[model samples]
Target: MTEESSDFKFNYFFGLVNLVAVFLIVWFLWYIFMNPNTVMKLYTPMYGFSLIVVFLSGIILMAKVLKWPAWYNRLFQKDKPITKGILLTIIAFLLMIGLNYIVFWGFIGKFGIAYFSPDSIVASGGIGAEPFVARENASTAIVYFFTAFLWMALFWDLGFGRWPWQNDTYGVQAWSKLFAILFFVVLFYILLFHSHVCYLFYPAQDKAAVTPWWEELAGTGSAFFSLGLILCTLVWIVFSDLLWEGKPWNRYEVDGESTFGKGFVVFFSTLTFGIILIFILLMIFNYVWMEPFVGGQYTDGPDWRYIHAGEIAGFFILAAFIWKNYFNNFPNLDSLWLRALIRSIIAVVLGLLIYWFYYSPLATFFLAKVEGFAQPGDTPLVWALLFLSIILVQSEFFDGWPLKRKK
Candidate 1:
């Protein structure tokens, strides 16, 4: 086979495998039904050892099995461009996120005609529970998990894009696609768990109870400190030389670099703190914590509370740290900064456009009807970052993040 064709075969092999796994999961769910303990056993780690080996081995097969040596290389390689990967990833994310909202609205509203029903979603009855958020843990899992799967197919294209059926290469090297997809599948749930999303309303009830999974897995209070250790190790590994002038300890994006330092710190700080805070918030606010469930075995939430953001949360934290170490610091905005700024702008515009086109209708249908749900601050910062993404994309990819740049 030609090189391109060979690559295509490699890419799709895993995609098919992942699809089969998903299908099996659905069929299993359809057959035996929603056994919380069974799913928990599949996901949970024991005695600080993780089931990551199982899940990652199963889901993470696309990269190694495909023999794509370029997977990790694309991220840290000194020569290969990372911007194209970023653009594709962001675009893919926007599509994924937008679709999730659409699908969610569809099931909840049953098209534009109906409203959310907990009974339908949780299989208990209807959506009118007072503390909706507490009662709908399963709802969040089902909606966001599958929405993320749709996104995974895009990333799989890279790793297995060279697979037999629809082999193609666009931006990233074919080897790295699987990691890209895996990251989002994990990340979306993390975002929702923290935000306490569309499950029901705030202060949920009746769903189920959680145990102390994270507090147990994290080995108690050392989550952040251990993250600090990982950050230090990566910093020293990448920029061990004295010539490394960038702030190895900081977090933020640099031009033509992975923004590892900033990203990792963001990963751990924001990501870890997001989960940690969720626990704290739920415990302190009795009304909010158990709002979804009516009242279960434990008045306090269960240990499963921390799974979404647990082990790999620090990897993202490590990623940002690495980015910073490589790029050093932000540019003066002369050659690079402008492009970075423009890329951010484009992302916002594209994101907003997608939101307007796809997500808006869904939101209007199901979510819009609910008042007091909108939290309206930070419009400027969010949009400004969007503009910054535009610039970053230009700086990284087309030599300038601009409207006029080559598509």
Candidate 2:
């Protein structure tokens, strides 16, 4: 055989090996996530992921995106990207667990409010096997909604360089900010506090009929409430960043060029479009994937299956964005459309591999090897919310990890 031919074969073999290694790593991470014991032991993946997301979002928003103060930047910012990422991730993880134990467990759970509760017979199999429960209350719901609003405001309104305080000087633009705040407050108030307004037309099924109006409205455990929160979070995740931009309605600028009336029109129009898009996506997911696997009644119950799918979808999108933005569309050897097509094909292939491995016996083998707490029928839905949250913070606030390039 010729030396050139031998070198060609060696290169091809190594390329195939590298591809297989990437697939294995991705599958392994997904397996660990789905393992019940791993989630049960380490404060649940929901809490773990949430801590990282919240911490990164808060730090990036205050220090980098907003550039609030010099001191704030000094405290969080690092010259080395690797060091910065690692330090921020570690600090956020420790802080979230510590604060939850102190504030949510010790204070709120103990005295102020019934925020955390010991698992009951229904949630836990029995007395001794109970896990820590994060209880929902009116106050907790309000706080959650408020944080959700902040997440939206940072990404949709402020990140896009839109109204109110975007370029305000001497309080001229103050009205726009105030109006924006009031509009969101009123909008979310109805969505979170008066959800029955929307659900009144639909048939009362599952817990909606027997549950009290207040509980149905504010209860975190309620399926409708959880669904609403997930939908709203998706507005920021899937819709606002991906679908809402570059449209004709979003053309209006807020930097003294566009009038308040125009800003109001753009805001409402884009928001309406986003909500409609969310409805269609949810309907398709629910009818096609969720209802088939979980039965209609349970599908409509807490709807965790759909929520998990949405989170996975969001992660997929984020991975694409990171590939496109952070890595500058790898291979860099084709037109934009061709590159996008290639990236998408890779994503779909990888996604299918993940699904196959997750259902395969390898997942069971890994689960058996690891011994941790296990909760039956409990899915890490909060992880989805936190995933969306961190993506928004990264894309909008930090632009992207390792490098601060705008999306």
Candidate 3:
């Protein structure tokens, strides 16, 4: 076999092995910490842990986006991939904890925004005043913050392809991108999330934020609409970047370089695609669960429907990542259209399977979730994000480790 063929075979084999490994790790971690069947039995800690993992992902992505800073190089420049992965994972964990407890909860939460601190939330009273409920809501609000950050981070990385920063050094590029992304993330969070969160309390913090603008159209004042929309956007972003090899978008280049105009087009194009994708998914769910009525609970609730659509999209995103990184994104073929079509179908099928299995009795047995679909205070996105974070850590921090055959 040619060296290329040999490499493909090698990756295809170990990729399956890695998939199984990741599945077990996800289950074990869930059981140990987040499982409702176990001591935790609450969604607050689950969301908190999910935030940490996603924060870890942001840090890891930042390292790569910046092309590895001098500090990172000095620390891990000589270490093996596995060792580097271990050390970085530990550091990421600690850093997230500090950021959560010290930065958000301790400082900003205590002195500035009460929403970031569960204690403050509870003391204030109103809706979700119970300790567990308050903490869960606080963590979820923060999760939304990070989720927006992740979306912007990936958008700049893949959609922009280092534009505007192309001529800058790593440090300059890193800070510029980080601050710019943060500006948008914070803006989006305030507009999209803060209002909904403000209303989650009793009497509603009408003074803190304006009434949710989408409440009239969406039938609820929940941020799930934003969450679902963003996650759907992510699905197309990943689909374009990985399965299509950045085609169509990359083809918009000028003189062999990615241009700001092209990147702007990419931004709005994927967003439009995301809107279409979400509505399609919602239609599918409508067929499955019947049309969701306003104020109805579970699968029948509009809020749940929107958020669940996002959760399902999260599965598609994970499947796309897994397909690219682990499965060699199989069916390497000559006809580009045919290859893309088959891969899209495969990824959707895989995502559907994941969605099914997550809501199935098996997940309840393993993950200790409530029976049936769209259970209150339970979200599959947390699990999906956790799984994706592991895959990212393996690829970014570990350098593909055991999966990367010796060059």
TM-score of every model versus the real structure: 0.28, 0.53, 0.91
Best by lDDT: 3
Write candidate 2's Cα lDDT for 1-407 as tens digits.
22222222223344345434434543354345544455434324444443434444445444333443333335665334445544454555565556455554566446643323222212323322224323222223333444444444444442344343555652344345545554765575444433432232223323433432445333223334443444444444433333223234344554434445654564565456545644555666557544422233444433444344444444454444434333333434435345445655654454345434434566456433222212333333333334334443443333243233222
Model 2 TM-score relative to the real fold: 0.53
TM-score pick, better of 1 and 2:
2
Backbone collision tally, model 3: 1
For candidate 1, the per-residue lDDT at 330 reads 25
Query: lDDT per prediction?
Result: 0.32, 0.41, 0.78
Assess the local accuracy of residue 118 in candidate 2 as a C-alpha lDDT between 0 and 100. Answer: 29
For residues 82-165, write the lDDT of model 1, one tens digit per residue: 554454435434543343334433454344212233334433344444334322333333433443443244223322233332
TM-score of 3: 0.91
Best by TM-score: 3
Over the stretch 24-121, how does candidate 3's per-residue lDDT look in tens digits? Answer: 99888777667766665434554644465456555645454554533465655644777777877776667677777787778877899998888888
lDDT of 3 at 144: 77
Q: Which scores better on TM-score, 2 or 3? A: 3
For candidate 2, give the lDDT of residue 159. Answer: 36
Model 1 ranges off by over 4 Å: 1-98, 101-176, 179-381, 401-407
